[model samples]
Target: MNDKKKKSDTNSSAENVEQHLQELEKADYERLYYSQEQTFSADELARSINEQRLTELMAKSDEFLKSLNSELEDFDD
Candidate 1:
C-alpha cells in the first residue's frame, strides 16, 4: 500500500509539472506573436536610419582620404 501511494504521488507530481510547462509555452508563444506585431514597423524604421547614417559616414571617410592623398602628393613635390 505504501509503495502504491508513493507511485501515485510521483505520477501526480509529474502531471502537475507537465501542466505548468504547457502553460509557460502558451504564454511564450502569445508574447512573441504580439511583440513582433508591435515592433515590425519600428524595427524597419531603425534599420533605415542606421543604413543612412552608415552611408553618410562612408562618404565623409572617402572625402577625407582623398584630401589626405592630395596633401601627401604636395609634400612629395
Candidate 2:
C-alpha cells in the first residue's frame, strides 16, 4: 500500500509537469532568450541544460521580464 501511494504521487507530479508544459506558449523562448543567435537553437538549449546554467538563465529571464513589464506599463499610460 505504501509503495502504491508513492507511485501514485510520482505519476501525479509527472502529469502536472506535462500539463504545465502544455499550457506554456511554444514561443516563450523568443521572450526569454536575449541572444538573437541562440533563439530557437536546440544545440544552445542542450548546452545550457547540460552545463547547468541555471543562474545565468534566471538572471537573463529576470532582466527581460522586467524590461517587458516596464514597457507594457508605459504603453498603458
- Please provide, for model 2 over 1-77, each residue's C-alpha lDDT reduced to its tens digit, 9 standing for 90 to 100: 99988877778777978877866755576656655554466876676674556778888999999999999999999
Off by over 4 Å in 1: 1-11, 40-77
Best by TM-score: 1
The C-alpha stretches of model 2 lying farther than 4 A from their native spots are 1-52
Over 1-77, each residue of candidate 1 has an lDDT whose tens digit, in order, gives: 99988877778777978989999999999999998887457778787677877899999999999999999999999
- Give per-model TM-scores: 0.39, 0.33
Worst 10 residues of 2 by lDDT: 30-39
Q: What overall lDDT goes with each candidate model?
A: 0.89, 0.77
Compared with the true structure, model 2 gives a TM-score of 0.33
CA shift of 24, model 2, Å: 30
Per-candidate count of clashing residue pairs (backbone under 3 Å) = 0, 0
